[model samples]
Target: MSIFSKIKQTLHLMKDIDLDALGKLSQKVDLSEIMKTVGELDDRQLAGLMKMLKHKGGKKGQHKLPPIDGDFYDMALKLSPQQRELQIKVRNFMEDEIKPIANEYWNKAEFPFQIIPKMAELNICGLTYKGYGTPDENYVMEGIIAMELARVDVSISTFFGVHSGLAMGSIYICGSEEQKQEWLPKMAKMELIGAFGLTEPEVGSAVAGGLGTTCRQEGDEWVLNGQKKWIGNATFADVTIIWARDEASDQVKGFLVRKGNPGFVAEKIENKMALRTVQNALITMTDCRVPESDRLQKCDSFKDTAKVLRMTRAGVAWQAVGCARGAYEAALKYTKKREQFGKPIASYQLVQNHLVEMVANLTAMQTLCFRLSELQDEGLLTDEHASLAKVFCSMRTRDVVSQAREVMGGNGILLQYDVARFVADAEAIYSYEGTKEINTLIVGRAITGYSAFV
Candidate 1:
């Protein structure tokens, strides 16, 4: 070929070269000198240069990631019209209202009392119960609400879980018809607040079996005396459901301990490293007198408390999914905009690997919680089923949050980046509801027919 024609062909091939990548390549090797050397070559050498240029430019197109969706499996498509509306309502409230001040409140370790009325306006408290102004929907809806609240702030979700799932639920599941009528309507309206006081300094996982707090029937009142620890919402709750052992029967019973009782003091636990916004209290009941009418008549034994745990643990699993989801979503968005080596770090193979593992674990957790709610709604849920979900989802969530922190580098640990909060809150979820060791044994007993707990 003519010399002029050869020069024109080389310029055309150079148009496809990624100059940025080529500049990086230049730093490692003599790209300018290499081009000069290439100009001296025959047609075979020129063809080889063209092939090298195309491969180095990442095969001619930018790498695209699938949309950053936590619900990778489209689980929301299964929701009914009403349920879908409820999800949207809660999600919007969380994203618009809670997301703005979540880190703010969490840093200060204070509860935002103002949001109570706003949250009540959603009419979602006591979500699954069938009477006394509750929505009476289903467990799936309840799980979705928990996830939506947690997607922005786990402390907020935990607060709600304590009031709605534990306290109100204790009344719903174990209260008599009179108790339900008197409490559920006001609690549902959010006019009166509630708390569940079960965990104590001496007992947590074994609360269902052995409680340190003692309750004894005396005349028209039951006298309760013991200390309860990690009791969320207890500090300000209008009524805190205190579970204590009935001394006469040696069985667990629930008492509606009213606020301002002379003998009930709920001191807020301070300096928490996680879920700091939740006002967990150390409650000490000294000669606390509760009327017989205030007793949860249905709770004659620890077996009744187990029913409450079985219901609430599933909500905890969903909360874990939300925490992982929030971190993954934040990391994904940050990676795409965060530039390194003259390109988005998200384009790097290792970053994508972290993201994939996160999404995979997230999707698995979401689906597992979904099925868990199904079993709950179907009345087929067991303690072991809820325990398995709590164990798996909470453990996976810790891994997901850690990877999320890794991808964000130094910013991952900072509250402004939004992922750091999840990293911290994940630790609380992993330990609460039942520790990893306790939950695993519960499942082990079910599958292996052997009690591992002594």
Candidate 2:
């Protein structure tokens, strides 16, 4: 018989079978011709076919598995309907737009500048900030957005955090009203991108005491001199918030250093194993003259700088949660698909044990961060609250991603598998914002009144 005739016959037989049953049977049956013939069926015939699909199983048409999502706690449901929609919008954007090209851009260590406008359309920059075109969302929404963004690509999240949380946050928290009015609006719109320069070549954890970078008052202008290392987004940032110790006052101050300023130079840091797409710059400032007005007006000391860090550090912890969730979800899906011996590897006890362990840690981290964001929204959050979460979540994420990589076996290390990127990115998350040792000490100080971060 012709292919159409064969398909018609098959559809006739399948008309009484459950759709799920038909699906499973179709996998084993040579139904190609039947499928072709069914394509030619009229609407009534198709409806009849669907009706037939309803009776092949017990009571239900077919037993299909639930969606294999990693949000085990249904945290997304906690968001407002609008917030949840925004979450899905970002998730769709990441899957459709970023995932396809993530490995390529990561391998080349190049930022995908083309997606900037697309990101701008999300209206997420300065997510929690008020005024100046910002969203004025709550801290939880901000954390959720950061988590969603990092779930697909940590580099993009880092780039955005530097711009919205660190750079603009510095202006928002420490800049004078005039400065905020001048900069926050343009930045909120992404018309101007920003960077934060704080860590120095010679000093990192010790930055608060004194940085090698120095700003000397020179009458109408301040001459900045020193180098900043690992300054994210600085390579092409329109404005960099350079933090340096004032030579006379011995206090750290913030300067709005414009791009292409004659005395400022930024070279991309290369060969980074983590967050390669972040465009970290080793910045050198030699007699860079910035106007006094450019000085962060309300920033009297390093205390002001710490205010911004305290705020963004919570978001970093949320990013760690995303990294863990992404890895765990990838590994779980891989286990279900990858076959070994006579059946799927997920059926193996050892593999299931690993999956359980990953989920346990991931769940704990998620719960911790959720509460942290809640405390922040309630205005009860402190540096120790954020530091504790950062230290714990980042540390736990390292373990989770490692197990995720382990579960994938050889494919775990392959970039195409997706878990490898999370593996590499976890290392950077562990070290940045605050190292485990440092953040732990901060929490230690808060709890026991002892400072060990000397």
Candidate 3:
């Protein structure tokens, strides 16, 4: 309000820059005479003087960019405080831990085995399951966790999904009480890794129709003879849940096949372009003998297997959302920093169009996965529900990643740029957990009351 007060305020604002310089200038200029002249100025003149002083301190007029968050809908706001905390925890873990090594391991086509102990500290595995050293969280939290994990690296997401969702899910849903007690606790703690063995080289989408693998009871043990392809985490997993059709009852059954068995061998699948960081293995079982007690007690038929797939399919939908989110955010940041013709590319209308489309798709995916997860948690989820989410999200993810790549130009194709990896990984997400065509038919069957694929 006062002249001396205003000058002091101005001086305080420029303390970092002008104090020493002003002392140096005082030696040359008559500082006392200059201050007396400046005190005569009006309020507006003082304000202008303050602005000039502030400018000298730093270039503070530059526009600041918003934080890179693909969740445009604020979906996390809908989460309970606890769930939100966990979501942030998982997100920080992915960004801090996995993002650094993602490209390195992906280029080598190898899984980072060292991350297990650090990941175990998160205490998030088997998040939705109750008891057996699990979190017993809701389906929404589980889906959010899926999104957070894949938001940085889809290979790790798939690896976690195969272990926590598919493999552990199978045991949780189909195994007997004893089996769950033995395996679920250790798997939940990351002490023992697990892999799902359902897709054989010969049978994939039609595994429910019949598995190529055969299992027959011989005395106290069942003999399992078959090969499973594209089995994630199989090479190093302590155990794999092998699905085989019973030779006698013609029913699909699950067996807990431990590693190091003479009859079981897992060879890593190599030279993969997509999801390279996931250690997919070709598992061969010859006369693999397992006691009947190890057989999943409730898994009497393929319907049980379908149950596990249906639940995990929703998680896959969430993964698609994450993949698209990462690509969108990456492209958005790159475009902001990337300039062409005298202005930033992000300032161009066409480039903004690509970004808008990516955000729109990403938002749709987040909202849809939320409701899909709600249905699952509410016990109202059907195969059609999961299938529709998988069909739509995976398809939209492909489009989003493509646009992301397009916006980056040639840099989009390179691994260092990150969009290229999303482009490749999106393809794997599109094909796995049920392909687009297969999922579409599933939704068609529900609405039309007729099975198109069958």
Candidate 4:
């Protein structure tokens, strides 16, 4: 190789070094003399110099970063011993059982059905629900559990939410005593898996005002006909809470549609980019006949369904905190270890800015969700409170995950690193339960004393 060629190659390599640090170094060192030495170097010597520049940028450095934690405010310290134990238990289950296979199963877009019984043993299902074989824990504990589940894997947390929060919650809040007796026990035991089906193919944000599914009271039954989309756990749930508008009353009602009740068909939704481990199903109910006894008698209108939503929406906010917490922690660890210019990238001011922003957003979300759950437990949680939490947390979670991905650079898109999945899953969380626009308007209506919902 020509001597001139080696110098050119060395100059190209110098571009990647931290320019600000390099400028400082130039003031302390004789760069012109260094170039004079470099121009005179033999080919082998130049090659060695280039290697040093590539790996260490011609400098040696060491750094010590504190242990990575997303809970900047130590929010967990407020938890009771039992609540903390429950949180650790869920976190261990996720890190031990789920984290190992999360990416692979997510790549295949399939649920790990084997974990269902194992998860059931936690006895955390329906934790906040009172009576009928429940731990009857507070809403704060339930929110913590949701956060722990999502911290490791968002999809599993989502599956649990659809069952424990939505389906069982429907039976708890809107079902008759007989209906609860028949479903809640087996469901609490995880013997009867459940799904909540309210979203329709053509309606989402407008579902409250315009549910496409309809049902009519027959002689001894109700015949339901419509399609529901993006229903989590619908494929294998033992029973589904199907909400449909009644033809006569024109109000929404809930029914326990058993898996194979004549015409209920659930096809797996494919090619999803987010929450792939969840078995979301596109349901087609063609004159699906459900017995009158299976109906949720207390579900008199969409207002009743709103009750279920208001309860679970707070939980969704907690899940958003988990998602953001996971992403921020991952990025923090990566930045601490990932090196540039012979030092951890986290040492750089700009990179620290990104990490700080992520944790700031995460901490804000955690404190907000804490209060949101407290309100829920105190029976002071209103639709606007839940909606505000959902809005702020879900929106901020996106920002945190985006920064998590950005700090990782190209590797952020690869699922092997886990941040990629968080990034993708955050998108789903942002859109589900309620979108930002819809939830914002809910809060707007409450404060302004006027409905802005279109």
Give candidate 3 regions above 4 Å deviation: 1-59
TM-score of 3: 0.87
Pairs clashing within candidate 3: none
User: Each prediction's Cα RMSD?
Assistant: 14.7, 10.2, 10.5, 16.0
lDDT by residue for model 2 (1-454), tens: 3445435444443544568876798798877766776777765575466444533345566554344567776565466546766777788788888888888999999999998888888889898888888999899988888888888889988998999999999999999999999999989888899999999888988888888999999887999999999999999999999999998999989999998998999999999999999999999998899999999988889999999999999999999998998899899989988999977898899998998889899889888898999999999999999999999999999999999999899999999998999999999999999899999999999999988876
Score each candidate by Cα lDDT: 0.89, 0.88, 0.89, 0.89
- lDDT score of residue 93 within candidate 2: 85
Model 2 ranges with Cα > 4 A deviation: 1-63
Q: Write the per-residue lDDT of candidate 1 for residues 1-454, one digit (tens) a residue.
A: 4444445455554755668977889789986676566667776666666445434424447664455568877687567546766787898899888999999999999999989989999999999988899988899999999998988899999999999999998999999999999999999999999999888998988887789999999999999999999999999999999999989999899998888988999999999999999999999999999999999989888888888888899999999999999999999999999999999999999999999999999999999999999999999999899999999999999999999999999999999988999999999999998999999999999999999997
Model 2: ten consecutive residues of lowest lDDT:
1-10
| Per-model TM against the reference | 0.85, 0.86, 0.87, 0.85
Residue 56 CA displacement from its true place in model 3, Å:
22
Please provide, for model 4 over 214-269, each residue's C-alpha lDDT reduced to its tens digit, 9 standing for 90 to 100.
Answer: 99999999999999999999999999999999999999999999987889999999
